[model samples]
Target: MFEVNRVTARSSSLDAAHWQRRLDVLAENHGVAGAVLGILHGDDMMSAAFGVTNMRTGAPVQTDTVFQIGSITKVYSATAALRLVADGVLDLDKPISTWLPTLRLADDAAHRVTLRHLLTHTSGIAGDVFTDTGRGDDCLERYVDGLASVPQLLPPGTGFSYCNSGFSLVGRVIEQVTGKVWDRAMHDLLFAPLGLDTTMTLPEEALLHSAAMGHEHQADGTLQPAARWGLPRSNGPAGGIVCTARDVLAFSRFHLNDGRVPDGNTLLPRALVRDMRSTQIELPFYDGDNNALGLAWFRQTWDGQSLIGHDGYTVGQNAFLRLLPSHQLAVVLLANGGPAPDLYRALYSEIFAELAGVAMPSPLHPPQGSSGFDTGHHVGTYLGYNHEHEVLDDDGVPSLRWAATGSLVDVMPTTEGEYEAIAAGGDLLLYREPGQRRWRPATFVQLPDGRSGLYIGLRAYIRAS
Candidate 1:
């Protein structure tokens, strides 16, 4: 159990000393270069920073230091789209082609996708198309124009897939309706109105802050700066927003407070806010009590309580946000590579347990006393974005062989059809159904158009015939 010590200047309910000590221990153990953690309980907010902002410069991370928030940008984009819905500028149920007719997909069914499908990630379009459409203002325009070459993974509205390109299209919709560039509209609609000082989309805007550079951990245990600062500007709406942990907590508070901004102005209607956080689609084969997709938010049930949150990754940085509406609490974690996953798991578990009375769900292990099951039915090749999965029978035991962009992982099964991905350092990455009751392994999904594909990581990979 975590104990509260003397109150700090920033929080009334938490012991800053206690969290600082734990963070220190976790960062040291994980070789983390830099991190920021922030928490909000009602009107009270507390935050702590650990490690260095840059490995070479050794600059200490300040509480307000900014890091790339990545796909959390999707939530901002989704909020912007819903605002358009409220203003009668756009209809959620209307076909996206009604607004951007120039956009094209390889499948006719996919071409009929609606705004709702894009927001919920059911558009079925190949989601990982991160081509650099240049830094010009017309970048997203070119991005959508180039979609003629992108294939449809499934017919639109059939299944959920994590679609980065879909969010980029949403950004284009914002541009079409608002007559402002996506990032400019984002600032005017979200950042400026929400009083978020550091949240921004461009490298030039980010240069104004004491920004943290991403650090990649090498095989020899050395850390180096990332070769690229970020993806192209056109990827902004998908996964390109940069902000501090404190600002992320503020954004979480806005959602918790029924869409009201800091100045008591309603940025969006209360009902739309509720709908955004409500379950929009059911995730297949998820292990949690009730895991589903809620607009841009991912929903999970823990200890009979509902948790809504989103996580983002960009280059060498990872960001996590978790909100407990019932408790009126939210937590944000930002890290620049080097064992970030391990630290986040440990820190969030302790914080949520102590503050919200919700236990961090246990890591998934193979079912107790497994009976031998037929492996023949599950053997085949599964595909993902720029990757392939090959299931093989290794001496009567099932195994998963994955190859992706010059990387490979071959692991024997710990149970039927699921394998324990062991890292070189002997870490167990259990990639089975609902590992941690949050994410599930890939499974076969059939489209309404009579096509089949593997649905994993919230995106479909059309199986090669």
Candidate 2:
């Protein structure tokens, strides 16, 4: 069990030795190739890096090492859009068509999409159908232009679905209003003003010297370097920015400090920043714990305290950032190897539990004398409230699989009754029902009370003959 280390309310720093030990253990035990972490409290901060930036060359990671920040880029993009709102060039309630005439969804109702809808991911726009080749700027625009081919899954502001398409549209809005490309606008509005020198939309010739080569675990349980590619110019607004731990920490702190620069320059109005952090949509697609959407950030409650941030995954990189508004605490974690499918969320939750003086939940463990049953029982066809599962044989051994969602998970029993579903592609959770005839599948569900709950919260499943 993870224990919470008592910290004083006035304490500005965590135990450096404790953080170092946790970082080392995460790297060694979690198959993480490289990790960059930053912790902020009040006016003081601590940042550290562990593991190799490049596994093949065995080069050590430095505090300044840059990693692709994945969807965390959305926060910056959303901030840029809100800044325009502050400047009176954009309106939160006005339709996006006010800025870009070409932007449209299948339904004519989609024309009602406002900057608020785009920022909170309620535009009802579908995400990109093609992978971001990271090749050029036209990629995202072409993707947006092709949206007429796909159907709208939900109506605008009716329900919450994480639409990457909404953010890409935000990028286009930036272009239309500022007369500058999304990348350049971001550089001017956010990065340059804050001195985040390591943040960039594309890998520059200079970054080649220190760029950490991303990697993935191979079939034989060996680490292999993954190829690096440029994110298309179009998708730059959604998930294209790359930066070091220190820079990300600075960005996160800006939100924690109410959208001001380190020296107290008011880059964003406090009211607007508060609006960005306020819950605009109750995201139904994500695990309904405290997961919510506020402007562009995922808002949640941890140990009774509110945290605002987002997690990102692309190519072979995974990143996470969390900011506690009440305490002015921020944490940023970046990893090269994608392990623990839920690595980012779990790490942040554990860290926050410790920081907030709560005991961390026990890790899940597989049933004893049932090693063979672990994969076999969870392998067959199973249906749940929001998703379906079809376990299949990968190499003669059963593995839990989801086709419609494109998730492939390997189950590992931790210690308690919980089982950890590790997907190289991502992470999720599985819990056995205590009294059912077989294992019950857990998925996202919307409660009738207008609240959200997980399947595990309803009842426990137990195996019966």
Candidate 3:
């Protein structure tokens, strides 16, 4: 980790070599099949690709190797919608039902759900609704239609829940306005204008490039080609974009340019671009202090400096993007297989510390200096979309137990009213913030109608007890 004060100028020669060595060591350490890491400091950008695209095929990972970026597509989807808003074709504050007429949520709050809610993830729709709506261009349309039967987890604009279905609905609105599919709309409005030729939304287009295959980690400690290569067509608007680390850096640079294309052409209103980085809601339980949600970006701070970024995971592939606007810096990492997250935490922490003079906050873990707080109130089964968490007190040891995944995580008190979930492998997985975060825990408050829930990572998990 290089300190900002310790370094003066951008030297691609020295920085590139240093980062390449770091990437190589990490790849070997984690057994990653292939990986790409990119960094942008002011006007200078450097990237290194290492390992094979697939262990089975032994295809080398080149600079242009395309990998599924997952939910980073939400930022592009949000940008497309902002374009429509810029042209007076759509309104940010207007209810989405006005544009996506077919969208009917189980809750009456559907009438109040606006484009802003969808963009900011405050629409209260369920997350992980990865239903396959077919490969036709009408996939987003059908996906929105199917959402009618989906139950609302909270009132629109009243809470935060990362909703892929909401972005799918936003895609439907883009289709209704442009009379084209979401992918086409994205190309016309953002990709083409930004000269992002290496980026694509479908498998066919991605296949034309040297693309990386997803790999799954096996119980025997080896990687095998994943069963599914691409997400369903319905997920395009949510997390279906495929691109290289270089192209992803270009996308990051475009946003840093205040919504301008490479040729200095204005693609979106600068104000809207600024608004995308502004706070929409507080997410204290997230990564760092003052963590919040922007229009589509996740905002947080490190060393009292603001940062923005998003992460994506599509089955076996994981990607991460982080931006420090104050320093005009961006770092992106794309990887395939199980050890991605571990590598990401280590690599990002080192890069950001050296390049930006900001310490990448360590993953949440119990403070060893202090004894754990009482875990009595937090003990219960909390349920969310297809996932359940049970906080238990087994023989005086507090732990978080997963229902479906069968993973038991020891809970060590990090501070008063907060606990860190220590994974069985001794890694810090997450922090359970009760009274300290903006949103309350399942036991924090009882709803007006006598219902209660736990707020973790912007999702409200109903207390299933």
Candidate 4:
């Protein structure tokens, strides 16, 4: 319920204390157990940590308190691969089979998967449900080898499906090619050079002394401890990282400064860093927003400017890292709680709106584009196991009617190629590729049959050219 003037430009200068107070207010409002906020601008960086790291002990959350970073580890893996590429030790386009010969997929298309596909989450591999399948040394490799037996959900590079297995494969590739473990390779290549001392792939035994305990919300809205087990060290590339808010900001500063450390060390080449921030695949299904997957980061625009970053979620924790390149501003939020995608979105929107002097809406809408095909043409009684899609009318335009678990909702188009679907007190935008296709809402999948399936996650509809 806060407002900022829309007409005035935001000053490059921000009041750190004021921002910290606002963040504290927001944390309380959201019933967050512990939170950390960090911002970096030019040579000046400010960070604040609040709430309790351990509710039982009433331990205060310190600025350096370590928290599980989840998938932000992908950024570390991607950077390591890019470093190898920069050093001529690896090829981004080479068949991953060159490094990991045992790699196979359910379909022959598996041979076509490359390092690029894995980095961009376009490897056609279905994501894995977390399981404690193996011991420390071979956990990631075993999981990756199992990928050959798992059915591919889509053709490589055809669409975006966030696949952690792909990243785990990348980790294996790193180990295979480098003759070192994934964590050690990452440390030698990226973390050590960047002086991110607090960023680590495995929690030290000493971590128990200072790490934050994750929390979950109970039915009565009370917070309770959420237990989480340590992931196998071999799976470090996917989500084994633990770090403090300040360390995250320092790592992000390299990207914000175009690959140079704050002290002027060129850890990553500027050209390669730019490529990492560039969009490799367009994720239209995630929301109407134009999201492009970089090497590991997801790049998007907010309020007319580009931001490069990613968010992470594991069993009992959530984290967000966003960098506004033009403003030389970056924000990192870490919370010890079950993953809350809505909270991340809301906070990001609220902060951006405040910075841009705009009125924050109930749910932020993705940028507008041309409306794609008329929804009516595709509207039908189509069904999937436990999921259904229906086309409905909205102000003379076609919209999606969805029914899941006996709950129904309508999706209306805000712009061409973009539609917003309302569900469970939240809205999500659907972005369409800009073109006419023979298959309307076609789901793309790689089936065991000789032929691939293009109707997996899509709805089929015929449209007039």
Candidate 5:
């Protein structure tokens, strides 16, 4: 309903003006309130902003307007741990319990979880759920201490299951080492040294800037600003940083530059930065997603051109960062709402093709002439951090019923939602989202611990035993 100003900074290879036009058109077409894009092409940085900061206020978005960067904060936490590793204050391969002796989880093998396991999401900690500890300096400590209620998804050092609690625990470890909370440590170590003036963690800090709140799409085809700003402060270490696209791009540049600070000091060792992009483990194919992860960085290929980056989402906002390390090119996209993953595909596919000569792979869709799929292996209840997934029989076809539990009810599509799906083949299920013709992919995959798991919406749900 609101279409307005677009601002841009130019570069040699990136046509900010042209891309601003494209962003404006695409944003409106996709019904997003606004989007900001920043690019770092071989040190030639450029940024463009399109649409409004808030649909309710009608204020236009600017290149510097801060939006929640979501789980990308995980990378920042990993960097913090690596910095400690660089200083001999922490050991990457050593058990985290060495640092946080009070650490507890429901799983028996939790005591063996190393910093490396947490960094790579192999800690097997059930992490989707987050708690709101009091807004105090000890919030992370309380959160980590309460992790005893969380069950294990797999086994430590086993396989990949995207874990938010793992990163938050990493924040707790950072606190123990530096005697500073996660936010202060990140600001001192990464933000200050990297010159990310707009990057911040707390809502109070974001209030000083032109912060963009998210807008949710309604079932009646309307956009409404999200009811909440972000997740609780306790979860801040995992998914709660707020920053401009430029800051996101700048952070990417630091890693791409091998951790060099602007004033010649190295914020992180070059080997550690490279290790951040190296393959720690391979993730199951998530269709158009990076299938490999390294210390919170996701590695994926486009036309055999490897890229290292991460994407994140919260409430109603989505943020994406992709760095073509070999090409000295990185891009960041921050959007308030809508089918943002689709927008990422549409815009980034072209950007990489033009700027990096890499072709983005097409997203997967349901194959035509598809036949009935066996639902035997995938039926049953799978437990997640925030909800339980029920694989049901919808008139002979497999269907998923989502039921939000614990603290996720506020963010779920509804208290309960169901999607009828047809398996494309072994484990790949295709289902059309409500009111959309496009079929989306979900999978019933095996966990490293050999348990059947459901992979959907970038979160893992292990079969409830």
Candidate 6:
């Protein structure tokens, strides 16, 4: 149980050493392979790392050991684009076709996509389109060209859909205007200027430091280092940056500083930085949890205190970054695997409650008796980018079965996202992994096309019924 001392919390006295020990025990109990916790409160900061980078190598995770930050890279990509806006080189509302005149998509309406659409995840592009163009300077260029034949899920700038491809498009746009690759631009613009020595965008660069390897749960119920490190290089702008906990906190500090570097040079305009955190679109569901999505940041509510940040997931690594800009506070947790989501829930619960006095909503739990919710809306086959989710009315009870389609069959985890979904009171279908009591919510929302959609693992699947 997480116990908060109100007096110490109210005083804002964060004992770093004490919390380090707590993290040590919590990481072990939750089966996390390796984890790092970084906190930023005003100008003061504290960080802790626990466990090994890789089970096979037995290398202890250090404070500076780099782990994949995943889609948190989107925020970085968005920041880079906003810099273009600050300089009057790029306009957020202008159609991207104005710059990339030859840009094409299967949907006719997609040609009108703007930078704002990409940043806000409303491009309606089929996101999991992970294609390997090659390890060359032309990779991003070729990746964007590949989208010519790729179909768009919905009309551009129409509705909410988590579009990874849209961010890759943003990377392409940055590459086009800057006359440099996305990785090189990152070094010249963000990393070197910000003094982020522990941050890198590729595996060869990660080899220079005590890098963390990703691990996966095997069929034999054991954790093993996976063969895959990350997705294609083309996907880098969307979810491929790797860095240390301290570096993440440092980056967070940069955001808190309103795009100013240590030398006090304004790398990004203060107005653009504020706009990025401002709510651009409200989600259809998740009223109190995730209130809305900003340009790249997630705008949320915790006990009515405004919170903004992003979370990321790759093959085996999970990362969370939450910031209370109002309080000038932030928390970042990067984990290698094994009950990471659960660990963060418990860990952040205590931290935020203590420091910010924000009450996180309780996790979904199965009721004592049957919750006979009408499974009518949920009964259908929901389909989206190489995935299918079928909600079945199993003898008057709702159950969700999901599977990866096409190339994902060879790439996804062992299971097909199987779950014994139980209908709940809050319009959510609850499911818990084997041997885990933490119930997860599978939300049902209406898609812009007026079809019922199921959101599982952050991706939305549209119902065919």
List the candidates' TM-scores in order: 0.88, 0.76, 0.87, 0.75, 0.95, 0.93
Q: Write the per-residue lDDT of candidate 2 for residues 1-465, one digit (tens) a residue.
A: 121222222234576556766776666666677777777777666666677776788777766778888888999999988889999999999988888787766887457878898787666555533344345656556766766655554467665556666788788788888988788889899999888888888777327646666776655767767755434556678888888877887887888878899788899999999999998866543343445778888887655667787877666677878787787778888888747234554566667777765432333443443233334334445432123345454553444443222111111111113232332111223443322212323443443334333233221111111
Clash counts for the predictions, in order: 2, 22, 3, 17, 0, 0
The alpha-carbon RMSD values of the candidates against the true structure, listed in the order shown, are: 5.6, 8.7, 7.0, 9.1, 1.9, 3.9
Looking at candidate 2, the ten consecutive residues that score lowest on lDDT are 406-415
Model 2, which residues run further than 4 Å from truth? Answer: 1-14, 131-134, 205-209, 285-289, 338-350, 358-400, 404-465
Which scores better on TM-score, 2 or 6? 6
lDDT of 3 by residue, 1-465 (tens): 111111122455438877878988877777777888888888888888787777778878876689999999999899889989999999989887787666677776567999999998888887657677789887887887877777777777777767888888888899999999888889998888888889999999988988888887555756787776867889888899999887888888888999887889888878999999999888624543337989999998888888888988886798999999998899989988757877887798899889778997655554454344445655677776655667776664556654432111111111112354532212123445322222112222343335566555456677765
Q: Could you arrange the candidates by TM-score from highest to lowest?
A: 5, 6, 1, 3, 2, 4
Task: List the candidate 3 regions with Cα displacement exceeding 4 Å.
Answer: 1-14, 288-290, 369-374, 403-450, 456-458
Per-residue CA lDDT of candidate 5, range 1-465, in tens?
A: 555455556455667777777777777777677889888898588888878878888888888899998999999889878988999999998888888877777765557999999899888888776678878988988888888888887778877778888888888889899989889999887888888999999999999999898887777878788888888888888998999998888888889889997777788999999999999888775755677888899888889888888888988899999999888998999999777777787789888888888998777666677545678767889888787889876666788777888877755545677876666877778776664444666778877667788887666788888
Please say which candidate is ahead in lDDT: 3 or 4.
3
TM-score (C-alpha) between model 5 and the true structure: 0.95
lDDT of 1 at 162: 80
**C-alpha lDDT of all candidate models, in order:** 0.76, 0.64, 0.75, 0.64, 0.82, 0.82
Regions of candidate 6 where Cα sits further than 4 Å from its true position: 1-13, 367-372, 425-427
| Model 2, global lDDT | 0.64
The candidate with the higher lDDT, 3 or 6, is: 6
Model 3 deviation from the true structure expressed as Cα RMSD, one decimal place: 7.0
Question: What's the C-alpha lDDT at position 288 in model 2?
Answer: 36
Error of 6 at 266 (Å): 1.7
Off by over 4 Å in 5: 1-6, 435-440
Q: Which of the two candidates, 4 or 6, achieves a greater lDDT against the reference?
A: 6
User: Ten consecutive residues with minimal summed lDDT in candidate 5?
Assistant: 1-10
